[model samples]
Target chain A: MRMKRLACCLAIAAFTLPATASAQGLLENPADLIWVSVSAALVFFMQAGFALLEGGFVRTKNTVNVIMKNYADLCVGVLAFWALGFGLMFGDNPSGWIGVTHFVPGDLTGGEAGFMVFQMMFAATAATIVSGAVAERMRFAAYAIGAVAVTGVIYPVYGSWVWGSAFEGSGWLSERGFIDFAGSTVVHSIGGWCALAAAIVLGPRLGRFGPKGEVRNIPGHSLPSVALGVFILWLGWFGFNGGSTLAADASIGKVLLNTNLAAAAGVVGTMILLTALRRPVLITSSVNGALAGLVAITAGCGSMEPVFAVLTGFIAAPIAVFGGDLLLKLRVDDVVGAIPVHGFCGAWGTLAAGLFLDEGLFQPGVITTQLLGIGAAFLWAFPLAWLCFAGINVVLKVRAESIHEQRGLDFTEHSEVGYPEFQTDLPHAGRND
Target chain B: MAAHDNARYSRERAVISEVLGSKLDAAGVQSALDLWDRKFAGQKSVPLIEFVNEIEAVQALEARERHELRLALYKGMIQAAAGPTTTAARATTRATSPTRPRVEFKGTPAEIVFLKIVQYYGEQLRVLGPAVMQQFLSELRAALEERRMPGMLGDAMATVAMRGAVPDGVQWGNTARMHMLAQGLYVAACKAAGPVQADRILLGAVNQAKQLEAAKVFAPSQFL
Candidate 1:
């Protein structure tokens, strides 16, 4: 399946050539297309990891619901991105803040399509993360609406400002030169913020708090699933970070190395802190912290040096650990620490881009540019998200199940149970009541 | 209930006793374990937080240097809220009622009609939560008696409110905008129900709250 995907993507890359050689100057090289295609595939696979991660975190009753949502997110993202979602996000009609673009290129080329595929994976990724964070009790239909809004509208529109909305130009697109080389602010933060809004509107899962409002530790049902999910996510990060390099150059190897190095250090850092604090090592924190490092290194993966990557990632772990608690303090119930791992750390990553980017990374004012990019993404995302979610929350019955029912999202939302019945169906016997 | 699902269970700080274990003051490990314990307890109250204030004590002892003192108390309470209750110094006048009333917006008395009725309805059910639990409760008792047949209220309310939190497509479809307003009453009703013994009370309360809130928002003044 992987080989076929790669071959098909390569075939697409070969087809963007124009009759005139000079016009080709404006287009991307085929290798970059290959790089993007592979990365997109990796990020796409993270959806599976997300499914298991969420399913395990929730109770046994809600496993199927979480898995189903992850599946639906991919469907929504593909359709939305292919349809008007892509056009609205990347179109050239920039009015200083927002704009739209059509999928059809006046004269179509396959290389550009590869970038579309790559970006599509990213859009899908952002969309999927929300499902896991807001899992278990949310109405499948209402949650689907939120997912559609994310891939179709939120992810794409914000994405267009930095990358090309429909077809990225050399200079301007989206809101005109919004500087996200890779989408730390654009992708991770968007997912994080949306998770924040949804969890808020939905309220805490039942029994998460006691009568006095003290939090109760809710343990996941599966250890292997959580561990495997983390490892899977860690493996996927190579594509998420390295593929952002856009080509198979030695520079990309640096991005990959730095990404791996950061994640490794993040694991060590979290473990050391956890142990020193004399706390048993928390798998959730460890996973989230490592993911945090990966997310932190994403924006500046190629731009910064190894030392800076270490600093950026090293800073990310503690921030996420502390940030996770901040959500509890604020009474915002994030199921998997989504707000801390993505939202808070995403913001930190963007800001770190400002502080860490050097000659190895970019020009002197790169810090300022990174700031502008991060700030604008927030200014654009936060209010719109709050409004969109709050408005829907007010209008619709956002909570599909009560606190008791929420303990098992699958039972509340879907018909099937997460854990399969160990015993098969018994011989049929009918009794009339 | 039979099994503990704590993934990190039994992995507490290792006590290296006999080997250099006799008097190893591993403050680093001790503090880390304490933080973990506090996190698990869901009570931010960590012991020996005073060391954070005393620089000399912290500086003098490396192990307790990075000690984090979490003040888990809420507002004025210095101690935890859930321990066994001590006998009061005096008989208390105020009562924390478990069966607190579900709030509602009673049809404005004769002088208030139509627009005023709608305003009151909006106030009671427009998504912020039924104005106040006390008022909502009194009005609910009256409204249920008047509009609903006593025997059939629960199932009916459950079906309707279970329809969902928000209306689809059209914004605030069928006065659903007011649904958000009733959230508070629903909460108070549940909290008032005390520790849940049956799913019926919660389901019934949610349904009733939704029904009352919905009626205020969905119905015309004449219906009220």
Candidate 2:
């Protein structure tokens, strides 16, 4: 009886809250609001996915630091996004440069609250992507500063250029008919390019490259953790992509199906390449391939054919592998290959949307417009990130000292360790060195 | 220093003395070792020897009978004063590892030549004394790392950029003439895009640098 009363109260509040005319029916439907809330919760759960993924990839000594960074991504992300990012991204601005309203979102209606909650997860997701790139050696203070900058300015300002229309007017990029049904470039590329800048500025971890410019392999600590993390991220992607629909319609099933197909194609494509190159069929590369596909399809999943989705994912596999190799050659030590999986593949997917959409690339100006958006994203993301990191580096040492890095950030930065082998008087056993 | 450090240092000193005995007279040998001690201070000598061995000038001498002697002098000085350290040991391990060293060019030949010229100037400019030199070198090292400038080029560029050859007591390095010499070498190397051209350009630049140093005109200038 009490549960019914609570439901009744929520229903009344939903109806009483002011909603846009277009959203009136949506506000009237309690079921739709519940779906949005549930979807937002699932997307928020992806923070755990990122935490495990990043933690498993870094050295055991730095595991706690990496996980801490992941947690902070959401903690800082939510506050920053609420205070400034949402307004900059979604508020009305005639110039189309930035959103000028909704700061702190104090007067939000019921529908707006649901929307804000959902978008908040995305803002957190973008911030979490950077945590993986600068994992072991970044200073906590530097990461915090970077998180705030990304959530508050770098991400939302560009988000205003693309995703602003869902709330008010579509960004100028959307005005040009650039299609990014979900953010491959807006979220992934922004974070990826930011990672690139941070990695470049941080230099490589000690001994990552030799005096003669020889590259060394720094393997992650835990494959099992990696596997679990990838699976969770894969599961969460259903909400990430499907929930973008913002409705419980039949089309969501197609989006989910397409998401899975692309992921499978990504695996097959990566495995085939691995076989051809005579490389081992390791799960790390496999997971990366699937992620690349997921990132690629994100731009067009809502509008693409299932077969084309597979092709997009298949193309993403090679792009991700080569993109990583390129960063290594450039001496950018992206710890989790975020630059390739997110930045490069994100750009490719955004452009591919123009190629595979119903009108196709042959359509006059569509390809050009998409190219413009892609170029704009890189031009905006890479330099702003470089400047942000450079500024932080000036205020605080962005990279840890050699001693701190050698001892591990877990103890040096956080005064704690993830594993308790010494305290327990047990053998040190976990994650291959 | 610990016993192990002393033992290691002594062994390195002995190896350097043996190597340079042929190329250097006794007094010259002592002077070189003093320079090394004054320059490198706390660093290890092993990597210094290894670093010089990687240099083309030292490599060219290796073709002659007195190559070991020439290398030893360079190695000894670097060990005693300034050259290599354990930090470089990690890098050396890769080069000597059973697996092939993953050799990639961090700097082009021109860039490396530019670094070598800078090192020579750094040594000459040491009359400015340790405090000034150390602070200057620290700034130079930071710049080099930021620019990915070769370590050899660090002190020279720093000297040129920060303390151009001037008559002021506080500004006692990077004279106007030295500025021209350094710039000439850098420009020559850049223009010498190919390997054959690199050797010619470097040799010519070094010759010009030597002439400038011989003149030793103390002129105040902002050529840098």
Candidate 3:
């Protein structure tokens, strides 16, 4: 009865708020929904971009492995999220620190199915981000297991605390109310951090470093693939940042503007820094910079002005490139910089929301509260993720195939190659290196 | 046999190093041991060794960022011995006119097959190249911008017009430069089209790419 009363109140509020507040911006709030949806389509399409980009970066032998990881992510991520993740993430709780038990189709307490769908997509995205970092060498089964944990447990339990109603007003749960108007922390970091953890465990790829820890450059197989993938991802950010508004309103235009500016800034940031380092515009670095900019702006997109957004992306670029190197120093072998861009920058994005926003930065000290929200999120998700990984590692005994790793997983596991014809020109196409 | 060979090689390397160093000094012997440790442990030298052969100087812009970058580099240089001149850079079909000289010329096998590819695809005389410039109106270009660059070769070249099977699953930027390169090669092949020895080798390479695509060894670009 209490829950139903909550439901009734929500339904009434949902109808009343949008209707009453419906004012006409040039883009209009309601029309923003279409724009936001289009943005989502781009983000959804990024899976392919990621597949090709990563495929091109690694040895061509691993190209099949690259596509497989992406394929598994979309297929499995949606399933886990839909089946149970939504219920735990948005459902009511005592402190919103963690959600209580609920699973299966009819079990969602959020009552509104739309919110669940949004959460589901966020969960899917967070889950997919890990595939890139773990890319070439991880066992297929282990990666699948990681996907399940992210969508079902790691993402939702943390998501609920900040978003859990503005419930129980201003406690650890409510005060910080994790102001992720979108999911820099909830989605990007969860994937990013998990990538960090997985990379640490997996160790570096065989030829990644030279003697005495000098890094060797492994040029991608196709610059065109990388370029195409980056363009695809750039198209996706419109949805990634825009959809966070969760309403079809004036916020849409601001979201779109901020998302675009930040991405451009990311490119600018990476290009400048890289040029300074005397490094050429690496397809990998520039592409990763674009992604970092996207991740940095995600939490603050709805609230920030354009200039601030450019700064946010610019800051994220160095953080991404260097942070990737930092992970390597820490002996983490993140194949795709997932942790740096998503995990490290996600955390920064959420916190930057407090530091950067205009007068509107989180409805007042909701900024401080947002920090608390992020803390709570860390508290909620980290241990759970660690345990989930521990469990998967124990059960699956997921180790990279020595022969397969040397041979490349594509032909070994999947019986496929990304470029079969390119083999003819090269002397040792099929011969295992 | 190879395993034994590798082990034998390792042993020889170790002996050669030790013998060479023993005549130097105690410091040299210690240094040799250190070198051995690194080699056996699979560590590379501290300073990086640059590969001189591998550097490719293909200066171009993001095809998505702008056009013309791809075309000027590819068509003006590799294909026509010149990338598209700025005036000719607008994406347009070349083989669209049936009367637009189907002139086939002959060269080596590599050249022979290039013409065949152009012969099969009517108007894409300048579509596929290394740089991402506006070239021929390609099924590939439209698909790339939409972020649905195909993984399979067939899907990449498949269009509403005269479709020929392009089997080389070499996924690169769908830039105008790349398109022009493809066109230049194919046209050269077409000009060489009368029965020739070079024809078989060129066709063989194209066929391999196609076979690989058929085998599902290749996937489309992750543009979308």
Alpha carbon deviation, residue B175, candidate 1 (Å): 30
A123-155 per-residue lDDT for model 3 (tens digits): 778887777777667888888888888887687
Q: Candidate 3, residue B20: CA error in Å?
A: 7.7
Residue B45, candidate 1: C-alpha displacement in angstroms: 38
Clashes of 2: 14
Write the candidate numbers in order of decreasing lDDT.
Answer: 2, 3, 1
Superior by DockQ: candidate 2 or candidate 3 = 2
- Segments of candidate 2 deviating more than 4 angstroms: A1-28, A359-362, A422-433, B1-224
Which runs of model 3 end up more than 4 angstroms from their true locations? A1-39, A100-102, A106-114, A165-174, A360-367, A378-383, A424-433, B1-224
Quick one: ranking by DockQ, best first?
Answer: 1, 2, 3
Best by TM-score: 2
TM-score, candidate 1, chain B alone: 0.19
- Candidate 1 global CA lDDT score: 0.56
On residues A112-206, what C-alpha lDDT tens digit does candidate 1 reach at each position?
A: 56656776788888888787677655778777778888888787667756665333332233333334456778899888888887887788765
- DockQ of every candidate structure: 0.03, 0.02, 0.01
Ranking by TM-score: 2, 1, 3
Window of ten residues with lowest summed lDDT in model 1 chain A:
A423-432
